[model samples]
Structures are given as structure tokens and as C-alpha cells.
Target: MMQRFIPLGNGYSDIYELMYIGRAMPERVRHMLVLHPFDENNPEASLALVMKPTNPGNFQPIYICLEGVPIPSKRYDLWRELADELQHDVIELTVSPSGKFSDQEIFFQHLIGILRTNHYLPRLQRSF
Candidate 1:
């Protein structure tokens, strides 16, 4: 299965879209994540939803709103509500902030490693 992070903008509109996707495709939702970056002073967090891989294509998409939403806010509450509706517990993880990486892709790679290590995601299958 090929998994990729599909970034949604860091804003109110983006979060609404994320919630919409979760509500629209509740069955596809595999996991809900709250990525807390290493910077404790930072008030923002990244929200994500892992979707099951598509049939035939085997493409698994992890939708994310990157480090834009504030913690303990109405937006976060909305996310938690969505998770409850989907019957999933929000998975919280500590990670290096995106700012620590030179590029977004690198940051995503790092996140992938963490998810796999924590057993939230399956190990990558390499075609030799």
C-alpha cells in the first residue's frame, strides 16, 4: 500500500473541509491524529485523519491540516467531535516541528517514520 500525506491549508476553511471528509467517508477513516510538535511554546497543532487504502489502486491518503489550528480551541473541539462520531480515539504524537526540516516533504517523511514505528501505520513494502 502506498501512503501519502495530503495537506489541507492551515486555516478555518481547511479544517472545515477536513471535517467534511471525515463525515462524508466515515468508513474510510482508519485513525485520527493530533500531532504535537516538540516546541512546547508553540500553540498550534497538526490534525490528521488516516484513510484506508483504496481498492485496486491501493493508495492510502492521510489528510492533514498542518500546524495551523490552535490547541484547546473551538476547532480542536470540532475535530474531537468528529472523532467521536467516527468512534475513534484521537491519537496524539510528539514530533519535531515542520520548521525543523528544510522542506515539507522531509517533514512528511519524518512523520511517516514515526507513525510506522508507533504501529499506527504499516511498514512500507518495497518492490525489489
Candidate 2:
């Protein structure tokens, strides 16, 4: 299987797009993730939707709003709203701040490692 992070714009107005995708492909939705990172101060959270592999294809796409929304835990309404809309359990992972990485590619690699370590994603394989 191939996994990839497909970055969405920050979760401002772009949240609507995320919601639309979920609603449109509810069956494909596998897991919902909220990655939180903090430095001296709390930064925006990254919201992601993990979709199951497509038929005739083994691509598991993780769609994300990369860092720029209020932490849902602090905002009960938004959290509840997301939970309700997703209609599935959501997993929260606290992670090192994105700033710790020198670049976006590095940040994604770090996230992929975290996901694999936590058993949220499959271990890398030479062949599927």
C-alpha cells in the first residue's frame, strides 16, 4: 500500500472543503486525526482525514489542513461538530511542533514516522 499526505490549505475557510470531502466520500473515510503541536505557545492544530485504499489501487490518501486552526479541545463546539460530522472515532496525537523541522518535507517525514510507530499506519514494505 502507498500512503501520502495531501496538504490542504490552513483550516480557515478551507475547513468547509474538508467537510465537503468527508460528506461526499463517507464510505472511504477510514480515520480522522487531529495532530497538536506546541512550542512556547499553542499553535494551530492539523486536521486530517485518512481514507481507505481505493479499489484497483492501493493508495491511502491522508488529506490534511496543515497547521492554522484553533485547537478543538479548547473549543468544545467545533470539536463536537467535527465528531458528529465524522460519525466515527477520531484519534488525537500530540507531536513536536512543526517548527522543529527545517522544511515541510521533513515535517511530513516526521509525521509519517510517528504514524507508523503508533500503529496508525502500516510499516513500510518493499512490496505490497
Candidate 3:
């Protein structure tokens, strides 16, 4: 199966759109994740939605807002809203900030590693 990250703009007003997708596609929803990065100086958070492979295409999509929001420790309401809308538990993972990586590819590679380690994502060469 093929997998990729689809970026959604920050959690300003787009959050409603994100909620709509989760509520509308409950069957396709695989997991909801909150990624937090805490560096000595910089702290950030991102929300992501993982979906099951589509029929006939076998493509899995991971929708992400990237490191656009401040840490949820300061804004728990967003997390609560997301949990309520998805009607499922949200998994939280601490990871290195994307800014640490020189390129977007490297950042996503790091994310994939974290997801794999947590069993949220399939292992390399494993078919979905």
C-alpha cells in the first residue's frame, strides 16, 4: 500500500473541516494522532488523521496539520474537540521537531519512524 501525508493548514478555522472529514468517514478512520515536539527552546504540536486503505486502490492517506499549532498543553480545547468529533481515543507521541530536519523528506522519515515504532504505521515492505 502507498502512504503519504496530506497537509491541512493550521488549526485556526480549518479545524472544522478536519472534524468534518473524521465524522464523515468513520469507517475509513484508522487512527487519530497528536504529535508533540519539545525541544529545549522550541515546543510545538500537530494533529494527524490516519485512514485505512481505500478499496480497489489500496492507498492509505495520513492527513496532518504539521507543526502549526502551539503545544496542546496550552490549548486543550482543540484536543477535546477532536476526540469528541472522532468519537475515538487519540494517541499522543513525542517526537523531534520538524525544524530539526533539514528537509521535508527527512522530517517525514522521522515521523514514519515514530509511527512505526508505536505500531501506528505499518513496517517497511509490509503490505496494508
Best by lDDT: 1
* lDDT by residue (tens digit), candidate 3, 1-128: 77788777765566566667888898888898888876756565788888987898878888887776676453446666767776878888888987888997788878877887888888777645
**Looking at candidate 1, what is the lDDT of residue 89?**
100
Against the true structure, candidate 3 reaches a TM-score of 0.84
Residue range 1-128, candidate 2, lDDT tens digits: 88889887877777768777888898998888888886658667888888887787888888888877786444324644766777977788888887788998788889989998998888887763
- Local error of candidate 3 at 73, Å? 7.0
- What TM value does model 2 have? 0.86
Candidate 1, 1-128: lDDT as tens digits: 89999999884679999999999999999999999888977769999999999998989899999998888899999999989989999999889999999999999999999999998989999888
In model 3, the Cα lDDT at residue 42 comes to 59
Taking every candidate in turn, the Cα RMSD to the unseen true structure, in Å, is 1.0, 2.3, 2.6
TM-score of each candidate? 0.96, 0.86, 0.84
CA deviation > 4 Å runs, candidate 1: none
**Residue clash pairs of candidate 3:** none
Order the numbered candidates by lDDT, best leading.
Answer: 1, 2, 3
